[model samples]
Target: MEVSSQHLLSNEYTEVYRRLPLKLQLAYGVGHVLNDVCASMWFTYLLVFFHLVLQFNNWQAGFMLLVGQVADAVSTPFVGFHSDQSDNFWLCRYGRRKTWHLIGTVCVLVTFPFIFSPCIGCSGSHQWAQIFYYCVFISIFQFGWASVQISHLSLIPELTPNEHDRTKLTAIRYCFTVVSNLLVYVITWGILHISSGEESKIGPGDAPKFQHVVWTGLSLGILCSVIFHVFVKEEGALGSSDVRGTSLRTPIADILRSVEVYQVAVVYMSTRLFVNLSQVFIPLYLHETLDMAASALALIPLIMFIGSFVTSMTIEKLNRCFGRRLSYILGVLMGLAACIWIKWGSGDQFKSSQIHIIAVLIGAGGSITLVTSLGITADLIGDKTSSGAFVYGIMSFTDKLANGIAVVIIQDLHKDPSNTGYYRDVLTYVCGGSALLGALAVISFLKKVRGDPLGYENVPNYNSINSDVLPVATEDIQPSLIS
Candidate 1:
């Protein structure tokens, strides 16, 4: 009996992996890498580019980012809703979610070059022109990114039904994401170091170097998209053909009516708020407190990548051992401690010896918090009644909202350059406070979700009818035929 049980478990594992085509798995992994590379590089360095290279004031730079995130907040959920409703969209050809993916890819390709283009002329009026250009391009980029990100996230549950497999797959994707972040750090730092011939360059007229870096990123984005499209095969839609139109009012009503979804969204938003707020301050902290050069600042992402990579590799084991809720609490507490240490204990000292150690601690703790939270999101989605697209859309929207709010708050708080000490203190307070709140929310939600295991019994299964071989019902096809 023991041997038979073991054999059955092994077979289940094999079947889980086999559910996704090998090419699709590779494409998914590669797509994550590309996505993070673009996102991390731009987000981490864009403020610096605007402030140091383009000569924008810190508030202006922060506000631009704030605007972009606001745009993301508005667009993500709307797109997800539309995509979820579109029955004949491209992804339906194979019953897979490929239509939105392809559309998102094309949008990225189109917007990428414009993102890199130098908007300001070399003449006297360049500064204002550059600002105008930055705002436009950044908005466009964010819009396109929202479409891609929401659709990509929505695809996760569709890709696999097994909970354990989903966890493993998520880990693999995060690993690739970390690697991409590391590469961006190394490459961009090298470029900045080489171009400036100094530790950091200041002023607005230095547009050429900035343009080159943006172009390089654009090129990489193009290559990554191509690779993803070539390898990934999205699964067609599953189950019954009752094409019921999802009521637009339902999502809003769900938001108001479902206590569970509201609680989850709040936790998600609070956690994101804490993380993003802290991230915005890292560069400033490095610059002011540690006196680190721009090249060294690049090491921030590298450290974060390493931490995220390690945590992702062992996430399943960690989840199994600690349980997701307790794990998140532990991670958030650790991250909070690190932030406090850096802010109160070490901010004034500015020692090179302490910098690396602090970076590692922050990175490790941040990674654990991020991964555990994402895992919880997957769990929540699995438990919910909504479609995969809608769940991800809601999550994405909440995150963007948090980010937008964080940017505005941080920007307003940090308007005065002379009061660096106060700024640091405020950041510490805000970030630490939010983390604490998120931990509390996680604890509460854990009580509600404690007994559930990842499974698909709750979801409708369409595979029994051989989704791939079934002919798509067209307008001309008789409804009677399908019945």
Candidate 2:
């Protein structure tokens, strides 16, 4: 009797494991902390580093990250494919995902340092040479992240089939992510100490300051990799007869044919795009345009995630009372409102309080959308025949492609030089418009979800965060039982 994911929400399945063991949840979730913190170090600071430190223009800097996202998007499917098919010594010894995790962590450590503090042909003359240098470095760094991250994600399903247990672990992971994000805020933006005029004199960025970011990424990766590999375990990953999802159908065709699945992808894409845009710019808005010190900059992510933590509880209740659609609509509206403030309220001096309010609103909105969307995706894949891996691959692809395109648009749109100023109008309209579009998607999502064949509408009662946007429903899922 293969239980569908929809069954997991019911009482019979939910209590199979009321909560995962403390040790397992902690180890698995902390792995997420490592992945997120390292990635955050890049997202939060890399653009600023490129513009300020590497002498890359706004487009050049944006191009590097966009390229990185491209590489990450391209490699992720291969990673899933290879993870399933590979018969390497590591797969034999350490299990499928663990082998890649170790390999990926090592690559992350090696490539991460080069991103912020590169030694590649310090040629001051050829702009192409530097562009090529950062592009390769950034792409490889992002690829390594995908390698480890995709495997980390696959573990959530494999670790336990109990919905309650898996949800708890997901919550734990998000909490750790909040902490990791704050840690980077402290390490990077929190410590920046330049006076108002110093930004122009040292354009590329401060080497020692960015080196802290690199070292922090490396150390966290090492520690979390050790904890995750040593303490966490996987089943049916390698050398297991019960391994699922060996489908050969055209994955793109499968996803495209399903309107609900495709709409869920849109919601996922829109949310990731808006958040990545915010991540890339908030530092610029704070450190550059507002002329805030490092310490003032550090508190933003903290305030934001804390707001998320505070409001995450009520989001689910809102969903239960008002439905995921209305809850999501409310979240988007809050984000749009915040963008309104950013567009108009931005001044020469940093209004830390006002921005903090914006952060809280965006954070809360993000939390609500994130929670409901995953529930929707999960409902889609809980079927017995669908390729959960393939659907997940599409979702990851959507996230990266949308994020890359959004960043490029922002960077190219506001190609202002360093120390000049952020084009707040450009930034605000773009972000606000993106949020407005997301709200529209949520409305469509609610319409699509109105009559789910698998009773998905009744199942989204989450009290915590879930990182995996990928799940399964009976009608939408058809697991590969043949292989």
Candidate 3:
């Protein structure tokens, strides 16, 4: 006898998996890999690239990074606002998100050549010219990055309505991200080795070598973008005809009017500020204080990759056993501990190997912080609104903005070239303090929602008259299946 309908509902979930389109499945798997590789490559290695390859001073390098991040911050929100306003924007022949993805791919292809171009005939005052070139190229690169990142992230919740499926999907995406992180670390190390002769000595003038490496990376990035565009499918559309026709001004007003949006935005901004400050300083600490080789510096990302891989594999279990809020809190606390260790511990006591071990532990904590916080942002948006694209755009903007401010603040703080030791000490204190403060803020927010499992109070009803004002909910929204 065939199973009854109720029995099938109760016993089978594999059917749901089978129902997903082949294109979606492939895109889901590949997108994360491509995004992680491309995104991390710039942030993780660019500092060293500028310092060693470009021969820029620490302050100068930091400022350049600051500029790129600031540009990212400004551009992301505008993009988000525009995206929310447009209907079938990505749906014109090519998929909705796919069109932007292709555009970003082309942008990367065009920009990579500039990044790798040699310092030939660049003498006298043209030193500034070289710096200007690098900065502009990086800024443009980030613009393309933000476009692809915001659009792609916005696609996630729309692809599936099921809360459980979203979590599962995010986990899968993170797993690929880990793999990409690892691949880039290995590849970057190899490229530097081949191009530099000595890992520590490569500077800005080796344009030919840098160009070769960047071209290869850019080609790979373009190929991945194409795969993503061709395979990824956006499943849902904005429900209301009015919403579809809504001017960009409407969503912008709506986003601005929402209080929860600002609250989430503040949290994202503060957290990113704290975390990235620490991240930016890590290479500086390794290079100046630890006097480590570039090859050794690569271990930082390698360790982070491993930690992310482990987290990706076990996130479901962690979320199930400990509620998402607690899991998130734990991750933040872990980051706090790592920061404290690096800040207060005696550096001279540890050998190079021991230092690397410490770096790994720190990396593990940082990995946890990154993955959990990002998941929380998605959940926060999900609990509050059905408009996934708009929410994701807000989150992305907050993160990038925070990064921009943090880079500028840290760079400005470390402006004195004469005091290397003092600079390191200051970086340690700032990073440690920021991490602790960020954790506290997150904890405070979580405390408000401790009793409310669904956090429904956090969601504001747009139809209400006072809806023009975003409200802070009395109860924190519970991290739940809906989020």
Candidate 4:
């Protein structure tokens, strides 16, 4: 009876999997473009906007970012827990994950524009009032951002059980992310070039340009979402042979007890901290320390993302050739080298060419580590598809909370006028330090895996841990009877 049941389920799984066309895959990948674009601006330009355009102090700007991060941290768990519910809520008629994704898309589309626009009723209000106004909008936008991110990510395990397919999906999603970020930089570059003089720095007059960016991102995001909803069906994505029955949500206690979960969490958090901090500070480093013109703000980041785009395209092949561990270590070394160069090699005086080189290295390194970490996360989850959202949520919770606090502390130090080259120090020590620590954590995790392959019993298909070798070839694994 058990064998027969497994056979029946396998047939159903194959049917559903086969029906998932390439167009659907492409649409699914494009689903998160809005979040990607918003994130680029939030990290790259939020400080610049608040401190320079709105005349907020360093602490104020940092606090606002913290507020958004806190909001995101808080919302992730709720979205994850609910979206994983086996039973349908009213919103789940369209599919549970899709419903949440749509809800998040709506919330972001409606609220994100207000963040960049001048305060409507209180444009000239007291500083505290303006701060309060922006905080409310930032919180809402962040909640939406988390909802979109977690729900979209959870769709991966549900969509298919094949590891290679999962990797392909993740790679495609990240490729879109790179493209979305590139679009943002290109747009910002074009707008800044036309709106301001070459010598002038970005200031209050540039608020409209941010608004323009927000609107463009929203327009593109909504269109892609429509395609996703139309093409991708979530029908065969849950528990049971028919894929319409209840899936047992993995208990939070079970998730907390898993050692591998913690390991992946550290990697994810550390990678995010490295990438986000560098992005946030690069514009400031250019404007304040180097005193580069407005165009450098966009041009430099553009170069960086171009490098990321190239690396992202090739990462899957790299992962196949070399295991996740070696690939990630290589990337971390590249990032560390970039950090060292920014710190000492650039010195008090540097050439434009040197900065461009640093940008490419940073971008390439960040892309590899980030992509590898996320792939590791999918592997860690293995066949535990029921609680996939919750796993992703908790990881993000740690990432956001840590990054928020780190940024706050960094900004407090930045507020001290006596400190020269503070941004440089931040880029070198803080960002570089994160890469080194993350590398250490990766080594620690591998050691633990080697000590006991069963350390992640909850994760059934950790091939990397199961064998002496780190990366299992794609063809060596068999498809599971149950998804």
Clashing pairs in 4: none
**All candidates' lDDT scores?**
0.61, 0.63, 0.57, 0.80
Best by lDDT: 4
TM-score, one value per model: 0.81, 0.80, 0.79, 0.88
Worst 10 residues of 4 by lDDT: 473-482
Residue by residue across 149-242, what tens digits does model 1's lDDT show?
7766656655654444456567667677777777777776676677655567434655665566566665776677778766665544221122
Instruction: Sort all candidates by lDDT, best to worst.
Output: 4, 2, 1, 3
Best-to-worst ranking by TM-score: 4, 1, 2, 3
Off by over 4 Å in 2: 1-19, 84-93, 120-125, 161-166, 193-205, 236-253, 312-323, 346-352, 383-386, 415-422, 449-483
Error of 1 at 461 (Å): 22
| Residue 342 alpha-carbon offset, candidate 1, angstroms | 1.1
What is residue 282's positional error in candidate 1, in angstroms?
1.0
Each candidate's root-mean-square deviation in Å?
A: 7.5, 6.2, 8.1, 6.0
Query: How well does candidate 3 match the true structure in TM-score terms?
Result: 0.79
Question: lDDT score of model 4?
Answer: 0.80
- Per-residue lDDT tens digits for candidate 3, residues 23-92, read 5655666664454665665666566667776666766777777777777776676555554443645443
